[model samples]
Target: MSSTTGSPSPDPLDGPLAAADLDALVDEWGDWAQVADLLDVPRTKVGTLLREHRLAAAVPRPGAGQRVPLAFVQDGEVVKGLPGILTVLHDGGYDDRECIAWLFTDLGLPGRPIDALRENRGSEAKRRAQAMAL
Candidate 1:
């Protein structure tokens, strides 16, 4: 007799991390409109960034809509090395949520992968991202 009142099945597209968990890991987030404002581009062009793997966004939590981690941008542009790292992770079959979670997770790096990228030590983060593919 299976019950129908427990937690719902996880969405396959949500990747391995829960939305709340992903939300907790990020300090700041911005929707595409905000991202456009930051990038000084029309809102429509923001979609191009995601398509190019120059940025990654996720719903964060139910009803939260899509949001990008603010750490991925700095100085009015996508942070240097972030695109390459994101590309690597995406190529490794990690979805947007997984990619964001991985970036914020501390796997014995000097800090989280996002932190390393912010500090301009993206080579270290990129190395880990590459290893994930294998």
Candidate 2:
């Protein structure tokens, strides 16, 4: 999933993590391990957090197996629907796992944590709502 010749630029998906997409299935099921993989963070980092019991949810099960299978998204679902979270991270001076950690922590909202993943998809809606006041 790293850079490749003629490969799409990083942050290919838009807005938050596109709920329709489950490429991050591991995150949904794998706990920190999958989340780390999706975010490209070192397993050790996330693992350490788990060992220390920092995460709010249950600690991920042992092994790197897919506790939660990942879901994939079509290109349009990401590009057409949202600015893509990867782009936001790129713009936010984030790279690699730290960026992902920041995203997770920020998106780990009180309710509907996944809604943060859809931030980009609804950005236009946000703008429209703001525009409605005018």
Candidate 3:
């Protein structure tokens, strides 16, 4: 498509690519049950966490369910800083999908936000999230 002046229209995929790239960060994402199993929690608790925004489903599966990014889990626990980061992002007016995208995207830190968190840089991640609200 072209604009009224005949300039080529921007690619529809351009904007979506940013969000879409989160899919590439992991070979596969997990469903709620998978996440609950990883965390050693009951499946119902996983639902509560998702509803409370303590955990997020970054992308939806093709058929019916949502997929949680693997980056958020470490050694069977949610990464130390993730819940707080999620809360900050949520307060900053980001939804679960946006929060996941932000975490996976490079934000000029040592690496992606999830990486920083994994490296025990939760404070830095939290700071960045706080900055987003400002």
Candidate 4:
């Protein structure tokens, strides 16, 4: 459900967003169809986009596909810099689940990375991810 070529299984949660809290996280996310509607693309394109790392799912859905966090979508499009930030984190050796956990965890910024993205602070998040690569 991650944006990687092979959807890696989620890592163990070591932050505020623990794996045990996934049920609550799912409530804040949406399915592929909803993501498609937000992006104004076909459902197939949604899958393509996800596979291409244009966006990412918070986690894998119980059955199939993933539920993308609403924070990643803005005005019916993926937020700017999100893909780049994801790439930075991935390049830093963080898997999809780790990325999710980090975003939900506060990095001493004004808020969590996901909250920063939702508030149009993706650049800050990207900067932090870049620093993480050090």
Candidate 5:
């Protein structure tokens, strides 16, 4: 499904890397409606999740709707430890787009931070995210 119109503007810090970088880093993204379907919740609940820092979404590119990286959810729930990582990143001044970009970026780990979280190796990713906040 297409993203809704009138999405909010990106944060001022959502730069250095372009939206295209995010697009390349993530293999797939799910719009709010799709994520809602996956979680078996109403579309409004997805907004709640985002507000709670249990999830994040971003517009990957101009003309595209806001979307969440498909990797953030597994089965019918958010991947374990993802909310914690998102909190760490957000506390460090990263808006959703920056958080998504950082998670998908490889920083000499066995894989991207998101992969580390998915593999239950979140401690290292959390540490790195903590450092990034400095």
Candidate 6:
């Protein structure tokens, strides 16, 4: 495991550790249902993306020329439930519609963040409230 002569490559998700750090993070990834809402994708599509991306385990380093078994927490979340999946995607900045489309045949949701945000935060009642306040 030497550099250019077989040195070990740096792990992308590596850094300072405080004893079982990876294990701890994996333990509290939270529910996929919340993640779906955060990602703005339907619950159904989560499984598809999991299987498609092979995201169940630690994602591999590109062209690292090594088999690094992932340090993933086994929450028994794959195929059956979309749990523990969306957190990774959403945290990685994949928006709702993108997450949905990647898993399903496109729910045809809005692609713009402003529109999406407005849809979530805006409403006729809210508009009226603003008007009245003014």
Whole-model lDDT values for every prediction:
0.83, 0.36, 0.76, 0.70, 0.84, 0.32
Could you give candidate 3's per-residue lDDT for residues 28-105 as a string of tens digits?
Answer: 588888889999999898889888877888554456467887667789998888889998888878888778877776
- lDDT by residue (1-134, candidate 5, tens digit) is 87878856443235553343677778999999999999999999999999988998988877898899889998899999999988887887878888888888876688788999888888998998898888
TM-score of each: 0.84, 0.28, 0.79, 0.73, 0.84, 0.25
Error of 4 at 85 (Å): 0.6
- The C-alpha stretches of model 1 lying farther than 4 A from their native spots are 1-20
Each candidate: how many clashes? 0, 14, 0, 0, 1, 6
How much is 45 displaced in model 4, in angstroms?
1.5
lDDT of 3: 0.76
Q: How high a TM-score does candidate 5 get? A: 0.84
Q: Could you give candidate 2's per-residue lDDT for residues 1-134 as a string of tens digits?
A: 66566734223224333222233323554555565676466767655533332222222233444322222122212223222443444345543332232333323243122243354344543233234223
- Model 5, backbone clash pairs (residues 3+ apart or across chains), number: 1
Model 5: residue 133 alpha-carbon error in angstroms: 1.0
Q: Compared with the true structure, what per-residue lDDT tens digits does model 1 show for residues 1-134?
A: 87699776443335564343777788899999999999999988889999899899998878999999988889999988889988888898878888888888876678888888888888878998899766
| Candidate 6 residue lDDT tens string, 59-85 | 122342211112111233232222223
Off by over 4 Å in 3: 1-20
User: On a 0 to 1 TM-score scale, where does candidate 6 land against the true structure?
Assistant: 0.25
TM-score, candidate 4, is: 0.73
Task: State the TM-score for model 1.
Answer: 0.84
